[model samples]
Target chain A: MQENILTLRDIVVEFDGERILDKINLSIRDNEFVTLLGPSGCGKTTTLRIIAGFVEPNAGEVLFEGQKINGVPPHMRQVNTVFQRYALFPHLDVFENVAFGLRIKKTPKDELNRRVMEMLELVDLKGFEKRSVQSLSGGQQQRVAIARAVVGKPRMLLLDEPLAALDLKLRKEMQLELKNIQQSLGITFVFVTHDQEEALSMSDTVVVMQDGVIQQIGTPEDIYNEPANAFVADFIGDSNILDGIMKRDFLVSFEGQECACLDRDFAPNERVDVVIRPEDVDIVPTQLGIFTGTVESSLFKGVHYEIVVDVSGYKWYIHTTDNVEIGAQVGLKFGPEDLHIMHKMFDGTTNVLQGEVVGEDEIEFLGVRFTRENLGLPVGAPVRLTFSPYDIIVAPEEDRDATVYVESVIYKGRFSELIVWKDETQLILRTQRDEQVATDIGVDFNFDHIKIEPLGEKADA
Target chain B: MKSKVPAYPYFGWMAVFTIIPMLFVLYFAFIGDDGQFTLDGFRRLADPYMIAIFLKSLWLALLTTIICLLIAYPMAYILSRMKLNTQRTMMLLVMLPMWMNFLLRIYAWMMLLENNGLINKLLGFIGLGPFQLIGTTGAILAGMAYNFLPFMVLPIYSVMTKIDGSLIEASQDLGCNFFGVLRRILLPLSFPGVITGITMVFVPAASTFVISQRLGGGELMIGDVIEMYFVGAEPNFNTGASISLVLMLVILIGMGIMNLFDKDEMEGMLI
Candidate 1:
């Protein structure tokens, strides 16, 4: 509901012939603290640079209060950046550094002194006027950087992970201090960082991005509660997302059982994804629950116990305050409203169907036979199956011939996703903590989870 | 401590080669041949001819140092900002002439500056007059600047390369134009290097006798006066030692003034 201060439309940037930012469109409102949250190489810093006019986008329009600023240099912009490394002038004292911009404008000496002293006090760096920049600690240097950038009274500020170099405690302290400063100054801040906790705790609007594309843009609560896709759900916090079939308005199927969900508005028997937060799952007695599993791991995570239960081949992560023993039988319970459903996205991983076709409507891939639609191909011909990563479940390794090697595992929050290598292609699968990297694991799937297609010339059909 | 013993060799070398020779100079300058101390050697420096040669030497050295700095500062600035590969190649080119024999290099300059030499031949081909450039203060000044220009360039280039790139960018971001950045950031940060370069060029240029002998013709410098006392027809060790001591004192004072400008703590040595 606030007035937009800056808007970027269709921004594209490339480095060394590789696309770093692709058609990024964003709008920052006045006096709002917007944080661009993403992992490294996600082009978050590039986006901040483009807004500050430090970098030019190959094609885009940067509008500042409805005025184009594409050709404006960094010094000419109404925005200033607190660079990640602080970039303080080593030869200058703290006072001179803070008064640099004012001196450049030929401000009177008395006025410059007052303004610099005011900024130094604002950043809690009083009495540091005569101290050289090189003698300050990392936290003090950060304060000097903030003072220098803000003393100019620019309309907007851009910070490219300014707290990234501080220790954890100092970083936490600076996060709250920076937020308070922004609020007091009423300057619209566009902050860039890879730390999700920093973004969610300090920002008014968190723009979650991945691989140069924005996944979702919302308030912190909106981003935390209702993530738009699997990537967003996996990135923001811990969630167990699995492939499900939305049978109807209030029904979905997963793990060979029908479950209830609040999400709806999908075609009958449409492939979808269901996400349930770890904190939402309640631990019940094994006999009194809908599904039972043994607790494979229990880790003390300060406020709660992060317990992983193995239900057949599926690992369900549950966050509970109660202590549970490992290898004990337990049950996971969640209400219908706890589930979130989203459309499936295929990330271009192929499956090799090496089955001896028994009949016209039956096919096999990864040692699992399925009754599928007619392929209209010869019985002995080879066929390939395509499936989304959301459908693949990462499990413990097996010494069987129908297995692939787990090359790597990346722990997002609750569930860890594995990169498995089968033949020469790599496939990503999200699973539990039962598997290690470089171990051969059996690739398992249910009959209803896969789709069949003809090979070679008839592939598009 | 055991670590202090390794420095004994350096102390011994300093005593034998530097300290003792300096003591002998002082002893010879003050004593007559009768083993008695007198002020005669010091009074020899008050001679008007010797005073004129000393003043001329000081003037020429000052000219050479200024010329070298004027040419070297810009060259070093450009070289230091060049790409690493290009800098190495250009640096090799700058140092190539120094690898040759110093006397041979001076002689090469003599052949080019002499009457009807290679340079005059080229000038005559273009109808310019064969000027008397071989035995003038201008020719000696040119030779000294050429010989010591690398000493000026290397130190300034070393310091210029150490100037942080971010400081320049920060100045620009703080609304500094190119000239403003140079004045506020670049010049002050590299002041130590400039001082070192000035000392490096001026000291050797002020005390050189070989270049004066080859190019000064009849006009004598203080170095020529000292050489005449020690190794020329007169061979007066006392007067020669006194003149050399005075020259050393003058160069030391010049270095002390230069060191004052190098107040910023920096490792000013090139190697």
Candidate 2:
């Protein structure tokens, strides 16, 4: 492995007693372009500020080049920042703004002029030496901010959504320019942005984050093709993730069909999630397709047509060059390699069962007996049993002996949530569907996902 | 009514009060006591005593303006950086004294600085001799600084608060210490406020006869001399008006230089 340039170890941060980043650990290699992609209020900017030493994390160490720099001020660190607003000094001209850091170091006048002019030329602002920073356009000001940051030759550069303020065209142009600058300088760039297109196109590595935790970290292709979980699959790009069961070593069943896949390392009947990219699905003739559906909507997206195909009440977004007329029946075919399997974040079992303590480590519920690690109680003691929602797998009406009545089915943009009632208890599970409310559906889940506790201690409360 | 109705009253007020009074001053400056148009009043400006009074008034005004700026700039800087709620409370306290009559506030200061007054009595309790605290140039300077300080502070505070905080952070990121940021960013950005504050304080301090008469113990400034010409045993309105016109020209020229000094790319963004 290449040498690591920076490492953040167990970094915890809180604002006003609310935890923002919980034990975040990240490492960046030398000369790597890493993008932290997340939504707003996800602590991406806070992480960048912690690296810049503008903010002090309540706990944890920030190591730069194997040296702890917890209390080091920003100027003393070998890192510079290009802020979100392009915080260029309005009082200074372009040349002077770039020359500010060099002047502070007390470099010789001739050398300072040469370096400042060279940096200005790098950013395509060679003749803007005398132009005040306020007179420049948003793109030009961003260039000035970049030039000002890189003129010091810091080991790492931190940019906090620097392209967000620019128009689309300018933002695209600057993204490429910034990537090229980072490569030529051979310095690590920790870029923070909510724009996934920029992250996918510009950076070598993408760190997908949600809330305060990093959901996935991998190369761009790894993050895009093989997302770690549903959150990663939903955030990185357009994906169709549905509930699946690994029927055997190489076969998976989803949408009432068993298909061959390339994933393994699960029990014979283990439940999992399946993510398929929009570009991976091919539109074929209705007879040759594996799953046939009607094209509900078709939008021309410049490069390709984004078609939403409704396959048995499940909407699958497919990007295809073949134009299918709206309301026309179509067929979709995806290869076995296209189906990516992810470990479920939560075991989707929401079962609440009354259990009787049979032994020191065993509990009996629903005429079934199971052993637990910490179910320490006397025999015949009453207990409450529950499970995670992610582990629940929904099957066709004919697949199971017991059926659950759907209480309500609400469709979020990327997926749907089904609150099913069984035995007078509500179990919330996620599926890729437009499943209607008040329907009966068969549900099955893994036995290992179950949790049991004494009746006196309420599980949820 | 037409849109011009409200403006008509203001126009009448301006003509009757401002324009006519200014025209009368000009007329009196150019006319002799015998009712003949002459330059005799202007020539009287060459008198040594009149010139001395004029110089004294200019010096005292300059001193007062410099003192007010020295005290107000730091206070304004501190106030501007405070949270808005605290700043509002502090600003109210700073402006509370201005709501009262100016003469009454001046009299309160006079009582505090009197020889046998509150301050000296408190000092005497500590076995210190009763110092002659009043009837000095320092006393008049103190009064001017105390009276005009808010004028100097408010403008600077307003400008300082409006400065984008990111600019200062950017300066520090560029390796400027606190003092360096102050010199390079804060001071230059607030130069317009400094100019306005100087004009506001100096214009009044330069022409004040009351401060000199009450605090300096009968010292005669140019305003006192102008008053003497207007209300002395033999009043000379011509000389008084001439003196006023000269002082006005001097202030205008000073302001012109200050404007030149403030002209930069940032000036257009300010007032």
Candidate 3:
């Protein structure tokens, strides 16, 4: 078993009687790189501060080297923190700043001078000993902050979004440099960041949190490839959900279009959603295609063309190499192995509409809703809409009374993300170039496999 | 960065206001009773009593500066750390009574310090001690310290508030404990304010009236001597004016040393 360098057990912190961290449990192995990733107010920063002894948890234990270290003041803890603001001393020069921790510990003068110089050189700021702190740039000031903390050679380092203030390019460079520095020193690091890419790139283990609770903890690839829930899956990457009703052992049908997926076993005839990625939907030539459609829109996406084809009466976004012009007819093809089926997250009975085109951006089908956005469909064009059993979203059961309407569409070179509204809830779906789903064709769901969070609803779909 | 002064670039401006006045004083300083150019006015300052008053004035100013500092250092530190609202309220409270009039404050003190006054009434009721709150060098010192303490404290507090608090933390992180941090970081960083406060305190303490007259009773202070020369048994206008001129010269010399100490602090603040 790996020895835990700094261990936190069921740490609960409450400020003003409101829980910020509700029973958080985390452990760091010796010399390991650990990152806490989450949105703002997710307790990641609070946890880092707890370990650094900057904040005292209301309950539970924090152990350093097997000793319960609760209530130890920040200065006395065998830990150093690099605050988000780079809390460097303004009055002191670089030499004095780095030597600060050493001097506090009363390390001998010769030893102090030697260690300070070595550390400054390590941060590549060797000749800045006599320069005033205010004279340095942001990046250099950040280095000085790092040197100030590490010069003490603490057992663990707590970084609270240290590169958060730097620009994107600087942030990336500093991220690599910080990671390399951690590797060379072989010291335990507990880093906090909201940037998903930063966490994935630098951490040995990634801990994702939300609402002060741990969402998932695993290696980066594991967390990315196998999400614990739909939220984790969607949050980590772009996902397309197609709603369908299960028909066979591993098959599902979406608006009469049959598809197959490899996923958890489900009840035969059970309602479910099939999750598929855009890259998974392969496009072939018209003569060899599985399904047929006419090109509604084709967008060049540098490496690939995002094509929207009108299949039957439905619009399907397809990633293809061939650039089919608008109004040109083409064939669509997909296989059974490309779908990832998951259980339906809601019961949608109000918004299943089957209709004909009425107007450009506005559709008319009784009181059922439509959007003037993303709907570029001509007034008379017929479209047989086909959603991968994955992308059809059912409003959460609690918002049964609420309804979704189309709001807007954003065009990314290869595909466009549709902004849809359900009552007051908003969702952005990265769909492909299409002859808009004429707000007139009127949106209707034949299958109810996919589900989503709606207005005034709780829990992930 | 120092601009060349070009041997008094503002000499013409000074000549218009300062040198013209100095020329008049100089002319008066040299004219004797015989109505001829002589050193009679300057010679009057050489008298033994005049010399005593000069020494007394210097010592009194020095004493007031020291006393103001002793009372102000902690007050300034505490005030700087206080919340803005609290500091402002306390300042108003301290200065409200002051706006009434310096002479009024002194007379009120006289009322309290008299043999049968409010202080004695309180002391007699306590039945413990009959302390003489007035009519001595101690009383004069107390009066000067009380009246001048705010001037000393305000400048220091303003400077203290401006000095970055992180610098002290930096010092502590560098291993200097509380006392050493204050001495090395806070004091030096705020030295200019301290110099200004000291100058402000000493200047008025050396020349203020009423406080000495009422509190010191009959003390032989320089202020008292100046008043005597102006309105005494043998009123000597020439000697009195000469004495005032000498006091002004002494103040100038004191200010020169003060500016020398403050140059670096002034530069630091500018940066």
Candidate 4:
């Protein structure tokens, strides 16, 4: 293993009495490219700032090259940062900006010119030396910012959502270029971003975090394949969770159906949740094998056909290359090896039982409603739903959705929320389901997907 | 009803509004006894009495500006470096002096600087005899400096605070120690403010009479010289006007040089 370039041990940060990072322990190795990926408000930015020494950690020691840096100022630290805005001095030209650090160090004029030229070449910004920073385009400005920081030859580089301000194509291009630069230079990079794909695509090690704590730290494949917690699994990628009880080694029951799942440290009748990725699920020709589902809705995304099927009155989602018409019968096929089992953190029993008939294009529980857009379901039709025993959600109250009030409406990035009353069950689906002023909704749920936790562990008031 | 302004006439209007007053001053400068042009006013410009007064006024203005700058630069720097609320409160406090009547403030300073006034009384409390500070060039310069300190401070302070502090940090990071940063970065960056403040304080200080009248016991200055020509001596309007014109020309030429100093590249050096 390479030497640990920087170590953050038991780090805690608090702002105005509210905890932003709690016991965050991260060790970045020499020449490693690590990306901290999370949703906004997950304290990814705070962790980056702590490493940069811009903000003093309330509790934790940041060790650089095995020396504790608790009281080190940002300027004195051997870590340099590229701010999101590129923070280039608008008044300075490209040469001046890149030479800024060197100039501050009082290097000889000839050496300054030589190094600034070398840095400009390193960032592929030759002939841009005389151009004003403000006159450079966004991508060029970003290149200059990179040049400015790296010119200092700091031990570690901290990038705080540096590419967030770029357009889509430029952002994608910058990602590849940044990765190339990191590899070529062999420098330790600790990058913070809310973009999951960018982190997965660029980082050698991806650290997924939530609520100020590291949920999982592993290679991109490890994070994608085996998430440490449900939050990590959900945040890293879309994982369909089913509530079930472990019947025995490799056997779990979900949606009132017993199926084999990957074995975990457990005994018989132990509650567990089985997580299955979307692409891992397959739709076969309609046949009465393990279970059969009716096509409730179908959506065609240029590359693949996404169909929502109603299996045993529960809505089951499947993505496929083959197109199936709405209201058509379909077969669900998945090997037992693909089903990953995780014990519920809250309660022993993972299996929960409750579901309702969902329509084709739209799904409805009691009061909870959802549009089956990509699921390829039909409108106002009875659809059979088949999922693992853990998928169905049997809750005392609704959290992700609303009932009686249609009470609140909120717009989050790529996701939204709604509150409606299903006679008695106030249900919430914190899913990327859009429900507008009067959007039709339907839901065919199964016990397999709703991994059950005990009602006692609702967040403390 | 607003009338449609024809284009050519507007240029004529501009000349009438702005150019005629200058021509009037120019005309008054050379008018003779029969209302003809003469050189008596120009000769009076060389008079030893008049020349002495002019030199005194010029030196006094220069002294006042330099003194004000010496005090105000640090004051402005301290104020701009303070927290926003404190900065604003301090600015208000500095401007408070300007809000009072100028003559009244001068009178108050007179009370402070006079032979048996506040300074002497305070000295008496220290077992020293009463001292005299009023009716002197130093007294006039003090009065001028105190009155103009605000004008000098505020512009410099405005420019100083507008400087992006990150530049300083960048300078330090690049190996510029604090003092080096001040000389290479802070000084050049703040030159425009100096120009503005100097222009603001010096112009009024160069011509004001009341400051010298009360503080210098109605002695001599360019104002005294011009007033002597108009109301004190033989009432020579041509010479008086010519003397005023000469002082005016001197001011204009100094401002022209200032404009040259404040050319394009240095214009951007504000802050």
| Model 1 C-alpha lDDT per residue in residues B1-271, reported as the tens digit of each score | 4789889999999999999999999998888777888878889889887788898899999999999999988898888889899999999999999999999988999999999889999999999979888998888998889899889999999999987665666676667777888887888778878888988988887777788888777667777778888889868888888888889999998788767656544332221
Angstrom error of the Cα, residue A316, model 4: value is 6.6
Sort candidate 4 into its docking category: incorrect
Fnat for model 4 comes to: 0.18
* DockQ measured for candidate 3: 0.15
Task: Return the lDDT, model 3, position A233.
Answer: 51
Arranged by DockQ, best first: 2, 1, 4, 3
Candidate 2, lDDT over the whole model: 0.84
In TM-score terms, which candidate is top?
2
Per residue, candidate 4 scores C-alpha lDDT tens digits across B1-271 of 6665767698898899868967776787888768988888888789887788888888899899999999988788778878899999999999998889999998998999889899989999989978678998788988999899999998999988977765665454434555766775677667789889999998888887778988988776787667777787478778878887888889889988987977754633322
TM-score of each: 0.77, 0.78, 0.66, 0.72
Clashing pairs in 1: none
Residue by residue across A1-461, what tens digits does model 2's lDDT show?
88989999999999886667888899999999999998776789989989888889999999988999999887678888898888776667788889988988898999999999999999999898988787889999999999999998988999999999999999989988998999889989999999999999999999987657888899999988888877678778888888889998879998898999999888778778888889999999899898999999999999999999999878989999878999999889999999988775544545566878888788775445667776567787788788766656787757553577664443433467667766655677777755654356876665578776677744343
The digit string of per-residue lDDT tens for model 2 on B37-100 reads 9888889998998888889899999999999999999999899889899999999988988999
Tens-digit per-residue lDDT, A1-461, candidate 3: 88999878999999897677989988889988899987677789999878866579999999998999897756567777777877666556778878877877789999999999999998999999988777888899899988888888877887889998899998889998999889888888899998888998999999987657787899998777665544455445545555577887767877577766555467877776555555666666678776677778888989988776766755566776767678876666666666666664333323332333467654443333344455555564433332342253433445342345543333332344454444344434444435232121123332333221112222133
Candidates, ranked, lDDT: 2, 1, 4, 3
In angstroms, how far off is A10's CA in candidate 3? 4.6
TM-score, cand. 2 = 0.78
* Regions of model 3 farther than 4 Å from truth: A9-22, A40-47, A58-60, A209-214, A226-461, B1-100, B107-127, B136-142, B162-177, B180-185, B218-241, B244-271
Report the lDDT tens digits of candidate 1 across residue range A107-162: 99999999999999999999999888888899999999999988998889889999
Distance from true location, Cα of B173 in model 1, Å: 2.1
